[model samples]
Target chain A: MPERVARRTWPVHAVLVVGALVMVAPLVWEFLTSVKSFGESVRVPPTILPGTWDWSNYTKVFHSIPFGEQLLNTVLMTAGRTAGQLLLCSMAAYAFARLAFPGRDVIFMLFLSVLMVPSQLFLIPQYQIMQELGWLNSLQALIVPGVFSAFGTFLLRQFFLSLPKDLEEAAGLDGANPLRIYWHIMLPLARPGLVALGILTVLWSWNDLMWPLVVNNDPEQMTLSAGLATLKGEHFTDYPVLMAGSLLATLPVIVVFIVMQRRVLEGIAFTGSKG
Target chain B: MSNRWWKVLAAATVVVSAAACGGGGSGSDGGPVTLTYAIWDKDQQPAMEKIAQEYTKAHPNVTVKVQLTANKEYWTKLQTAVTGGSAPDVFWMNGPRIGLYAAQGVLQPLDEQISAAGADTAAYPKSLVDLYTFEGKKYGLPKDYDTIGLWYNKTLFDAAGVKHPDATWTWDDLKAAAAKLTDPAKGQYGIAAPADSQANYYNTIFQAGGTVISDDGKKSGFGDPATIEGLKFWVDLIKAGSSPTVQQMSDTEPTQLFSSGKVAMYYGGSWEANGFAKNADLTGKVDVAPLPKGKKQAVVIHGLANVAYAKSKNPEEAADFAVFASGKQAQRIQAEAGAVISAYQGTQDTWVKAHPQFNLQAFIDQVPNSVPLPRSKNTSAWTKHAEDLLLKAWTGEKDVADAAKELAKAVDEELGKEK
Candidate 1:
């Protein structure tokens, strides 16, 4: 039995190894190219290793733009969006899922309809609103618009609906109000859903390129993604510098994933299993 | 439940009112003025900042903040800002889109400001100045101009025992040298004839005495025999194994191929100087020559210009700064920094001298015979058609003439909608 199991698993392991290598190859290439000389970086039949590891490329990334400030902006923007979504989305989702409100279904459907429209459809109008609010080139511009997500509300609403009514009814008999029940009873039981939503929001906010690029222009005011974009040139780009900047910009996210990878996986799995 | 709905309505009302009342705090009277100067190239940001500092020094109360956006996103952001009525007070404008912006009343006309400052329009290249003029009114002041040249690797030339290209070299000379320089065993090509319009074919088309667009900007020149012949020059090189296949060129850009010494020659722009100068391997080995002559001596020239937003709060200040940023002093600073070839006529000498190793003067010398980059009110619409159909021809999937005819029809249709 053991021999048969080992024989069957070898092929599966081999295929998995190949798939993993394919996924990792580009990232490995990016790191290698970041340390290569400008000439070696673009060498035909491209070189796998650099003759000399140019450490200065990393330093050049810092000098070219305010990497430190942009990183901080990215962190703050992500945190703000995640916090705002968790509080606002949970409240709205609870009201939709449990409360007996007039036109409740219609309002919820109206909110869900936003998910059908493309994000780009809102760009012009949102930009105009941001301009009117004098928020262009501000950190608030990056955080505020991203905070309210209809998808988050929808996800949490489904999670809330799945919860047993006995806990809420017991809390109600104990003289707990809807807000108190949501905060103390329902939210604790809905931990997996909240974690899933929070993780998704963080990832989306972290990697968002177009919105940040459009909203902010100053290097100091920009997020890491937008700041890294400035390294590209119109006609010619220095691939080494760009790669180095990108590696540095994505390092924090990679580190976060490494530390909280199990939670991220569980959250993703929870969503997938439910779907 | 009703209370919750009322709370949501109240929050919505607050957001809407805030948006409606939130005025962008710019262009106030008498206090210190901070003007945003939006640019695309981070490579030239230092020189731009220096120019801004100088402007602020002269006008102490006015502060110019230089905002750098990447080239790919710059236009999209600009379009959004313009439509939203909140564009930067002053921003960089390119040739092809100037007409569109001016027609849409997004860019303020610079004619009155130019006259008031006594700025010599003749100081800049005539082609550039004419390129920015829309409906007989100038809307932009030329900042920096770039022209194409034949950049070659001297080590490869020496290895192949081929003589170096010079000013007097002709089309046949280039072809012969390409044939000699190509080495299939080494996986090296003599040249990279990518289907890039600006660096490769457009100059050749003009040199062959064909115009990309009619003077009236109402017709496409791709259908013309001379234009097809010019395009075929690259195609023939590809066929002869002297240039990379279209697929190869696309996979790895021609610029990368040339920089890595995989290709011996590249028809590139003046903007490549900074990138090449920074590369350690190609430092002494690379130099540029005037593009080899075809039926005539011609190269394509284009430049950026500084234009004020039409709805800027401080219109006068924005217009003045726009003109100042493109004036002789700023151009000199830009040239000395080796950022670009200044559009001002007399400032190019400094730019040529900035890079002594390469013969950068070949670009300046071609100014007399240089044709302005072909543009219309909607250049991108037609340019997109050219790219798609020309790719088919370059890939050998379709005949060049057939592709050119289809491209011409599409371009003509786009142009016909311009007015």
Candidate 2:
């Protein structure tokens, strides 16, 4: 068995290394292209690396609009969405897991149905809701519609339900209220799930284009992704600068992913087996 | 790590709550004078800002705030905002949605405003000015007008030994030349037969003397023999290796094909002239030709109009700005900069001078033969259905005759619902 495991390990490592390189190709190209001068990037047959590095693309991003403020806006929006979703999803999950409620299955199923519907169908009605709330062209317009996600609720619910009830029963006997039990015992236990959810939320919210582009037309409130689109006019192609802007926009997420790599992996591993 | 997460979470909550509480900053003006001016292009933001400043210069109390959004998103957002009573006071109106938005009463009737402003309606092209007129009331001022023309790469034509496109050229002459020039194996194409309607087929359809929509705008013209013939030219061109596949062409707009020197000639819009003029490789190597003849010479005429949003708190200020924006001074600023083909007569020469090379005058001449884009109550919703069905036809998913019949039925259904 040990010899078979040894024999399999080499191919697995080789496969993983190859898979890892494939995943990083776009990032590598984006970084290399970002460093290239606009003239070099558009050349025929395309250079693998820039002959001369130009940092002006990053500076141009700032010059084009109030990019710094927009960056701050995107960060705030992503963070707001992540925290709100984690708290709301976990709380709802705990309720469905521990507490008995009337028509709970029916309500949960209704929320799950939202996941199956095409997002485009909800766009018009969602825009109407934002306008009614007087949040059009505001940060709330970007953050609020996404705050309560059906996917997050459904996902976290499964995690909550699968947790051993004995652990919570012991906490309950210690005179912990349901809320206290949720905060101290349940949430810490669900840390890996919460981290996984948070990372996913940040990534989705940061890369989101359609809704933010629709809701926040005001330059002041526009997110990084939408703001990056205006870099090209109807003509006058500038591939290098566009690549640079894209890399800058993605930097924060890449940083977050790197920091939370362990927890995210553990969460994935746990979910794979349990699922 | 946990502390970091908590800190980030706390910081984010504070920012979102702060923004939510900002209360739109409540336009410093003490009175009820708030105006919203919607624009589809953020590229023109500076120009609009200047117009707003001039308006505010005269009327100290009126403040005009610019609301700019991308094209498709703007209309979708506008529909919802209008329904919810938060539509901008003054917005950019296009021919397609004018009737729908107006019929829904989401837009204020500009009949009084037009007469009040004493705007010279005669200075605008008759066909274009008439596009915004329904039931004898003007809904918008023609901000800028463009016509479809042939933009060609002189270097490619020279290499292919094809002569320049001229006023006397016919459709058959173009096909023979394009076919001879195209070499698909070499990644080269002769003409870009894009499936774009306004710039590509609309001219051909109009030239063939077939209207896209019926007289009452209640039926589809796709079943018309001339319309189907017009559609076939594009598909036939793709099959003959005279053009790229619809999928390949759609990946890159045809103008990019011309810029990359892969295509010899492009049937592009006059609006693209400014963008093309700025391309260094294309600067001296490009030129224009009049739309080749079919049954008669025809070109698609498109323009944007300044519209007033009904939900605006300050309608008067918004109207004043709209009128001023379409006035001679602003029009000349855009024309002289060669940014657009100004709608106002006599000021068009400045646009010609904006780009010294190429026959900009060709556009000016074709303006008389231009036909306005077809419109109904809800132009976009109806137009998009035809666009998608037609795209499928281009991709060989459906036969041309069958696709035309389907498009005709679908367009008829949408037009029927409009009634």
Candidate 3:
């Protein structure tokens, strides 16, 4: 019986291993390329291993732009957006899921409608709003627009709807106000939902490229993604330096994901299983 | 719930009102003036700042801020800023979009300023100056120019026992050299014949005595037999096993392939000299000659120009800065920095001297016989269609004649829309 089970699982393990390798290849290539000299990076039948692990590419990335400031901006932008989305989206989702009012369904539908339109359609209008606020080249311009996302509210709303209502009713009998119940009861129950939304928002905000580039021009005001973009020239690009910057920019996010891997997976699975 | 909604509305209203009132901080007065100059190249940003500082030094009250966006997204950002009515006071403009921007009335005309300053427009190449003019109004001052040349690998030529390319080499000499240099065992190709219009086909089209766009810019010239022959020049090389297949060139760009020593020859632009000079591997191995003669001796000339915004608050200062940035002294600064080949006449000597290893004069020598890069009121509208259709011919999936005719028809339709 053990032999049969092992035989049955070997193919699954093989497939899983192949899938993991496919996903990891580009990242491995990026690291290898980042450490290679410019000449070796572009050589045909590209060398699998570098002749010399040149670390100047990292120094070049710093010299080309204000790397430390941009990294700080990216962290601030990510943290602000994540925190804002969690609080606002949870509150709105709770109200939509539990409270009844005039045009409640209509407003909920209106919120969901925003998800249908492409994000690019908002670029020009958002730029105009930022210009009016004199927020161009500012951190608020990157954070504020991203704080309120429709997808986040919708996902949390489903989680709220899936929760049992008996606990809320018992709290009501104890004279707990709606906001009080949300804070003391629903908020703790919705921990997994909030974690999921926070993770997604963090990923999106960290990698957001276009809006930041369009609104901000000052090097010190820029984020890592936008700052790294300046390294790319029209006709020629130094791939080694670009790869080095990208690897540096993405390393933090990778570390964060690894640290929160179990929580992220559990949160996603909880949402999927329930709703 | 209702209270929450009201609170959100109140907060939004406060934010909007605050923004509206605070947006007027940059109002023009008899105070220190700041002019924002937008550009796309990070490598050239330092030289641009130096130029800006020169202008600022002359006018103590004025300060210039240099803004950079990468080339890939520069247009999108500029368009968004333009729509928001907050574009940079002065910015770089290129050939393809010059007509589109000028026609839309976004570009401030520089003719009056040029005449008022008695600036000799003759100081820059006439073709480049003509390029930035729309409806007989000059919208920008010529900044720099590039012409195509035959860049070859010296080590490959010596190894293959072939003479190096020079002024007298013609189409036959190039073909013979390409065949001699190619060695299949080493996975080496003689030349990179990618369907790059600026570097590869445009020069050949003109050399074959065929125009891409007519003198009046009303039609496509792909239907002409001479143009087809010009295209066949590269296709024959690929078919003869002397050049990389289109698929291979696409995987690794022709420029990169040549730089990596996989290809022996590349028809690259003068702008490539800086990059080639910087690459450690290609050092002492690469040099350039004037493009091999086809039906006639010709190359394609193209450049960028600096233009002022039409809605600039300080229009006079903006125009003055634009002209000053394109002056001979500023061009000299750009040349000495090795940023680009300055468009100003006689300043190119500095650029040529900046890189003495390669024969950059090969680029300058073709200036008199150069044809302006083909552009119309909306060049990209047709160029996009041309690229897609020409890929069929490049891959040998379709015959060159059939592809060109299809391309000509598509380009004509796009050009027709410009009317």
Per-candidate fnat, comma-separated? 0.58, 0.25, 0.53
Assess each model's interface with DockQ, reporting 2 decimals per model: 0.39, 0.37, 0.40
Residue B41 displacement (Å), model 3: 1.2
Quality class of the docking in candidate 2, CAPRI style: acceptable
Residues B286-373, candidate 3: write the lDDT tens digits: 9999999988999999999999999988888889899989998889999987758999999999999999999999999999999999
Model 3 TM-score on a 0 to 1 scale: 0.94
* Estimated TM-score for each candidate: 0.95, 0.89, 0.94
Model 3, range A1-275, lDDT digits (tens) per residue? 59999999999999999999999999999999999988788777789998999999999998888999999889878877777788889999999999999999999999999999999999999999988877887777877898898988999999999999999999999999999899889988998888888778888888889988998878888899998898888766788999999999999988997998998788667656312
Q: Rank the candidates by TM-score, best first.
A: 1, 3, 2
Candidate 2: where are CA atoms >4 Å away?
A1-18, A29-55, A101-133, A232-240, A271-275, B1-13, B20-34, B381-385, B388-406
Q: Is candidate 1 or candidate 3 better by DockQ?
A: 3
Docking class of 1: acceptable
lDDT of 2 by residue, B114-227 (tens): 678787889989987888877677778888888888888888888889888899999898898899889867788989987789988888988888778997888899988899
